[model samples]
Target chain A: MWYVKNALTRKNLMALTGLFLSFFLIIHLFGNLQLLLPEAEAKLQYNWYSDLLADNILIKIIAMVLYLCIILHTLDAIYLTVKSKKAKGSGYVKDRRGRASKWYSRNMMFLGSIVFLFLVIHFKDFWYQFKFGELPLDANGNKDLYTLVIKAFDQLWYVIVYIIAIIALGYHLLHGVFSAHRTLGLYHPLYSKIVKYLGMAYTIIMTIGYIIIPIFIYLNR
Target chain B: MKIHLKIWRQKDSQSKGEFKDYTLDDVHQELSFLEMLDTLNLKLVKKGEYPVEFDHDCREGICGQCGMMINGIAHGPLKNTTTCQLHMRSFKDGDTIYIEPFKAAAFPVVRDLKVNRSSLDHIITSGGYVSVDTGQAPEANSIPIAHEEAEAAFDAAACIGCGACVASCKNASAALFTSAKITQLELLPQGQTETSKRVISMVKQMEEEGFGHCTNTEACQVECPEDISVLNIARMNYEYNKAKILNK
Candidate 1:
């Protein structure tokens, strides 16, 4: 309640939700990495893993939380963007952006929108198909999510979309990960440095892992 | 050395502003940035033209009065240098320098390069002081403070309320400025008495002033004349979040 009304509190909300999503990226990347195993083995392993996640009560709870994090993060971004625009007043007659910070840092809202569009397409294609759309069962009787993924990746345009989305995700994470820590008040210089490096590592690894999955699948197919 | 300047000229807050170009061939590299502006103003005055108006006080960097965006930087190209402290020597002959006011919704242009920064004062009034009985001065060593803590508090106390942090921030956020006061007081035993109330009121006043949220891009710290740490912002958030959850 306090968060929705106050700008500072709302920012705290954005940071909290944004960090949660960042954490989710690591977990999601780990699970999806299973897609890189030997073809037949990967198909069985990924499907079993996917089904295990789908059937687990804990995963369901986490899924709900993830959905909430996404919604809150988007809404908070919109609120902060509107506030920032109004507070900016008239445009500067001479603009020199990125003199200090990165370009992505200033255009977080724009990057977030691209990532949001990707999420919508991503969820509709995989999550929706697995849950509601007709999906064949694998040898282990799990939803044939692996086949669906390969089919999606087989298309050059779909693979390109995933690559573009992942690139945007990389830029978003570049600023978001460390910014979230600062938002949560990580002030100590040494610890802040450690967190900064850790954040960069996470962003690099997650983006690479996600990018590799689709490309590997598309190529092998 | 001759210097070309593109300066923003605004008549008033309600009027539209424009950048007017002026070439000064008599500029000396030894003159400070503000002094160079003074020379240009004198020329305009001699010609019966309206002189450019700006704010300045101590000329020394400590006063925190004179600051304007020089080429889109909060206090010009030199890092951690205030406008009054910047010498024309930092520039080269025939370089086109752009001078403008620190732009923010809260910092409306008063005239030429001067902007109203009273919003910062209102935030301080909300909760920037310690209130105790004024009967007598406390004993010098009454409350012992750690040496590191004292030093840290002093560092936070160095903020000059110059609007550079807001001007440099991408979102025009005043988190750095507001946080400096919060960190300064929150570290002291005397400050702990009203820490909860002070942070709550100050942060609320900051938002009411129409400043944007802090995205922690850290451009403010890069452009801050005092070299104020962005960590101060984290400290402020810590105090505010603590007050919101625990104070209730």
Candidate 2:
């Protein structure tokens, strides 16, 4: 209860949930990478992997946790944003405060809203279809989620949206990853510097990795 | 040299405020920013008009009493310099300068270019000091503090409580100011007696003062006159979190 009311405690929750979500992105990317294989093999392998995750008890629990993290992260952000708006007394007549920080660092909520919108479309298309909608079976008797993925990305506009969303995600992580560490109290200068660079590297890799999947699929199709 | 000014003018806290333009002729390039304002005030008073009100003391950067948004940047465009220390040479003769008070919900405007910063003092009063027995002065080496630790503490202690961090922050957060005070005491042996209590109360008091949460934009350190590090914020988080876990 005290944690709920405290600012730092709320930030701690934000950091923990954010880091967990960041970790989940790595696993999600690797699993989805199977879509890059030769078409026939790709369909079977990707579908099989999807089926494997669906049937596993641990993956189901993790999925629930992932949903919870998303909700908490979003709600906390909304609360913090409202509090900040109230704290800012009035608008400046001739403001130029932007020079002090990066554009993306200051516009995190805007970037996050983009990513959040993409998540809705993403879940409705892939996640909902795989879980609740009817899908034809593949050669391996697995639900044909891979074909769904390929068909989705094959559309030029869909691929463009995917790339745009992934880019937004990259910018979000650029600030979020290291910011989470600082919120959790990683105070040493050497280690903090290391984390800062490591965050940049991770953000770059994740962005490239996610962006290439949609582009590669759209082009190769 | 001639200078153009668009300064905020308000009769008092209850009244609405707005920018009023004025021009000063024969302005010296070497005048401090405050002195330039003084000249404007002199002109206004000679005509039996109310001089524009602002805050300043010591005329040096050390007191931290003088601060304003010079062209929207707290403490002016110069890095690591205060309002009083900033000379008019930084600006061009024909340029227009906009001077505004430090604006925040916690810092209510008392008049033109002056806001009540007592909210900062409230945070300090909550737990910014140590409780020691009244007695003869202790020996210098009695505590045996490490040289590096003393220096680090001194770095945090260099904060003059100017409220530039609050003015510069997009969220109007006082994390840098509050954390600097917390870190200065938390680092030394003398401050050990109430480490857990000190962090919790100061942080609580900070939130109670209606300041926003720090999003770690690092602007506070950028605008801070002392170049106070954002790492102090991390340290404050470290202390606050540690106390929460241990105390509970």
- The residue ranges of model 2 lying beyond 4 angstroms of the native Cα positions read A1-3
Number of the top candidate by lDDT? 2
Candidate 2 lDDT over residue span A172-212, tens digit each: 99999999999999889999999999999999999999999
lDDT score of residue A61 within candidate 1: 100
lDDT of each: 0.91, 0.93
Which run of 10 residues does model 2 chain A get worst, by summed lDDT?
A1-10
User: Compared with the true structure, what per-residue lDDT tens digits does model 1 show for residues B1-248?
Assistant: 99999999999999999999999997899999999999999999999999999999999999889999898888898998899999999999999998989999999999999999999999999999999887889897999999999999999889888899999887888999999999999899999899989999999999999998999888888888888999999878888888889979
Residue-pair clashes, model 1 = 0
What's the distance in Å from true for residue B231, model 1?
A: 0.5
Give each prediction's root-mean-square deviation over alpha carbons. Answer: 1.5, 1.1
* Global lDDT of model 1: 0.91
Model 2 residue pairs with clashes: none
lDDT of model 1, residue A6: 87
| Per-residue C-alpha lDDT of model 2 across residues B66-143, encoded as one tens digit per residue | 999999999999999999999999999789899999989999999999899999999999999999889987887878
lDDT of 2 at B105: 92
